[model samples]
Target: MNNRKEKTFSEVWGEFITSQTAKGVADITIRNYHQVLHNISKYLDIEMTLDNLSKSKFDEMIVEMRKVGIAHNSIATYVRVVRTFLHWCKAENIIFIELPNIIERETVKETYTDEELELLLRRPEADCSFCEYRNWVIVNFLLNSGCRAATVRNIQNRDVSLADSQVIFRHTKNGKIQVIPLCSRMVNVLRGYMAVRGGVAEDYLFCDQYGGMLSHNALRLAIGRYNKSRGVAKTGIHLFRHTFARKYLVDCGGNAFTLQKLLGHSTLTMTKRYCAIFDADIAKNYDNVSPLAQLYHPKEKIKKQSRAS
Candidate 1:
C-alpha cells in the first residue's frame, strides 16, 4: 500500500484548495487560506511532508509569528487556518498525527461608545447634495439594521418595503437571507433618501453618481473622511455594525440567538462575545442595583418600642 503520509504538504494543500473550490467556498476566503498556507511553508523553512507536520512544528510557527511582532488577532487567524488545513488532511487520510485544536484569540473590544455614535449620526450637515444625503442614510441604516458592509452594498430598491417596515438582505456574508425590520426613524430616513434619489433605472438603493452600485471602498472612504473630520480613532464602517449589536442587546433586550440571526452569524460564538461585552457594561453598574444592597437598608423605620414589647 502506498503510504499517504509520504505526500508533500504542498500537494495536500493543493488538493485541499481543489476541495474548497468544489465546495463553493468564496473566492476571497480561498485566497486567504492560500496566502496563510504559503506563509506557513516559508516560516517552517523545510520540505514539510504530511508525516513531519507535528503539533510542535505548529507551535513553533506560532511562536515565531509572535516574535516578529504580528498582532495577536492575525496570529490567531493563521493558527485557525493551519488547524483547518490539518484537519482536512486528517479527514482525507493524509495524516494521522494528533493536532492541537486550541488557538488563543485576543479579546478585542472594538465598538463605538454612545457619544461617538451620536456624533457619527449627526456628522453629515444638512446638505441637499446626493453625496451628503446618501452618506447620512447609509450611516443611519447601518446603525439601525446591524447589516454588514457587503449586505448594505447589495441592498436593492425592491428589497426595501416601507409599507411593511422591513428590508430583506439577500446577499449576506454567510449566504443566509436576513429580513430586518425598519425602525420608524430609519423608515423616515429611507423615505427622505429615496425622494432625493428619485426614480432611477438602477436596481441598488444606494448608488454612485453614474447610478452604479455602491462599492465597499466608497463606503469605507465615506466613513474614513467623516472619521478624519471628527478626529475619531478606530472608527471603521464595521463599527456601526458593532454599535448596532451592542445597542440591540442593551436597548432592545436582545439575546445571543436573536443577535446571531440579526447579524447573520453562522454560529452563536461571535454573538456571545457581544453579550459578554454588554454584560461587562451592566456589571459596571451592578452595585447600585444589587438586590441585597438595596434590601439591607430601608428608607422607612419601624416602631422599635412595639417590637421590643
Candidate 2:
C-alpha cells in the first residue's frame, strides 16, 4: 500500500500566511493567527489535515467553540480566519469544499460619555505617578488623532514632524501612508514626552524607562496599572478611538470616506460602524428641528369671518 499523504491544508495555510502576511498584515495580527490556528487544531480530535476538512467539519468546529463558552464574536473571528485560508486554498488549486458562511459579527460601540471623559481627564489620582502621565498621553493621542492602538505601538520618533504639525504613519495595516496634522496642545504634550523620555533616533516615541521600544503588552500593563492607581474603571485604548471618531463625525461633519482613510480601515463598512456610535448626537440634532416650528397658524381674516357669522 502507498504511504499516507502527509500534507495538510492547515499546514499549507500557516506557511502561506507566514510568508505573505508581512506585506499587508501587522506583526501582531500574524502572531494572533498562529495562536488561533493552533487552538483550533487542538480542538479537533484529528490532526488538522487538508484531506479531512470539509464544510460539515467546519460547522462542527463552531458548535464545539460555542459549547466551551467562547463568545460569539470570538467564534466569528475563528470562522473568518478559516474562511480566508480555505478560500486561498481554492484559489491555489488545492482541495476545495463548499465555503462556510461567516459567523455574523455583532456591532457594539463602547464609548465614553462626554461627562465621563471630562471627569477622567480633569482629575488624576492623588497617588498618581509617571504611569498616570503615560495613560493621559495615550488617551489624548488616541482621542485627538484617532490613531489605532497598533499604529500607536509602532509610533517612532522620526514619524513626528513638529515643525510641520504632522505625524507620519508609515506601517499601517491598510498599506497606505498618512500624515496627521497635530494641534498645538498635542504638539506641546508630545514635545514634553520626548524631552522626558529620550530614545534612539530610530526608536519608538513610546518607550520603556530604559529607553527601549514599548511593546503592546507593556502598554496594556501600564494602562492597567494606571487604572488601578487612579481608582478608575478599567478601559481599553480603543474606546478613545471610538470617542474621537463619533465626535468628529457628528460635531465636525467629517466625511465618511476621509474618516475611513484616516482610520486605516480597508472598507467603508468599518467607518459606517462609527456612524451608529454617534446616534445620541445625531438624535439631538434632529430634535432641534420640528414641523411645529414652521406650521402656519390660521389667518386673522378667517377668524373674523367666523366670528361675524
Candidate 3:
C-alpha cells in the first residue's frame, strides 16, 4: 500500500475537472461538480492525501453535514457527486472502497397549479415590450415542452418549425437533440414571438433586451419577475417542468414510456418519479387496466361482503 503514489484530494480533483472538460461535459455540469466539491471540502480536508479515504470516513462526513442542518436531499446530491469522483479515483489506483447509499426520502415535487397556469398563460397586451412578449412566449414553451431553462435559452430561431409542427432542441440536459412536437397554441404563440424576435436563424430563440443570448441568471430573474407580475407566488422556472409532467400523465392520460422519451431521460429512473407522483392516476384507472378485473366480472353479488373479517 505504501508503494502506491500519493496524491492530495485537491490535486486529483483538479485532474478530474480537466478530464471532464476534455470529455465535453456541459459547463453547467462542471459547475455543479465544483459546487459539490466545495460542499465536501468544508467537511473533509481536500489537502489530505487520498490514502486516508475510507467508507467510515465518508459516513462520518455525512453525519457532520446533517448536524449542521444541511438538507437531506442536498447531502444526497453531494454524496452522489463525491461517489463519482471516488469512482474515478479508484480507476486511477488512488483508492478502492465501496460507498454506501444515502436514503433519499422522495418528496412530491411542487408544480404550478391550474389557477397559476391560467394567470401565466393569459395573453400579454398588444402594447407589451419585446421582453414582455418573449417572456410570455417562454412560459408557454416551458409548459408545452417541459424543457430545462438552459435548453430554452440555447434554442435558436431555426430550431422551431411551424410547418413541421415540431421544435428541435439542440442544447438539452442530456446533450441530445430532441424533436418535440408543438401544440397548436404553442405554435401560434411562437409564430407571433418569432415575428417580433426577428433575427437570423443563428440568433438564440430567447434573447436579452439587446437581442443576444440570455445568461442563466438573466433567464431565471426574468421568469421570476414574470411570474410575480402574473400574481404567481411560485416563481421557480423548473416548476413549469413538474407542472407539465403532472398534467401530461394525469390530465392527458399519457404513458410512462412516452413521457420518458419526451422528457429526454436516459433511463426510466427519473421518469418513474413522475409516475410515482401521479400514482392516484393509476388507481383511478385501475379497473380499466387490471387484467384480473378484466377477465372476471363479479356477477352482481347477492349481498355485500360482511363487515366482519
Structure candidate 1, residue pairs in collision: none
Clashing pairs in 3: none
Write the number of the candidate with greater TM-score, choosing between 1 and 3.
Answer: 3
In candidate 1, stretches whose alpha carbon ends up further than 4 angstroms from where it belongs are 1-15, 34-42, 45-56, 91-98, 105-108, 126-129, 198-202, 251-253, 266-269, 284-292, 302-309
lDDT per model, in order? 0.75, 0.71, 0.86
Question: lDDT winner among the candidates?
Answer: 3
What's each prediction's TM-score?
Answer: 0.79, 0.81, 0.87
Candidate order by TM-score, highest to lowest?
3, 2, 1
What is the Cα-based lDDT of residue 292 in candidate 2? Answer: 62
Q: Model 3 over residues 1-309: C-alpha lDDT tens digits? A: 633337777778888888889989888889898888887988888887777767887888888999999999889888888888878777877678788667676778888989999999999999998888899999999988998888999999999999988999999877889999999998888888889889999999899989999999899999999999999998899898888888898888887778899999988887876445657567766887899998895666587677986
Prediction 3 global C-alpha lDDT: 0.86
lDDT (tens digit, per residue) of candidate 1 on 1-309: 336567777777788899988998765578888888777775674466667678787778778887888887677777777778877877877765565655555364578877776766774666546776687788899888888787888888888899999999988767778899999999999987887776543378888766678776787887687666555675488878877887777666677677888887878986775434656547655768999888886688665566564
Candidate 2 error regions (>4 Å): 1-5, 8-10, 22-24, 38-43, 46-48, 66-70, 103-106, 123-131, 251-255, 290-309
TM-score of 1: 0.79
Clashes of each: 0, 0, 0
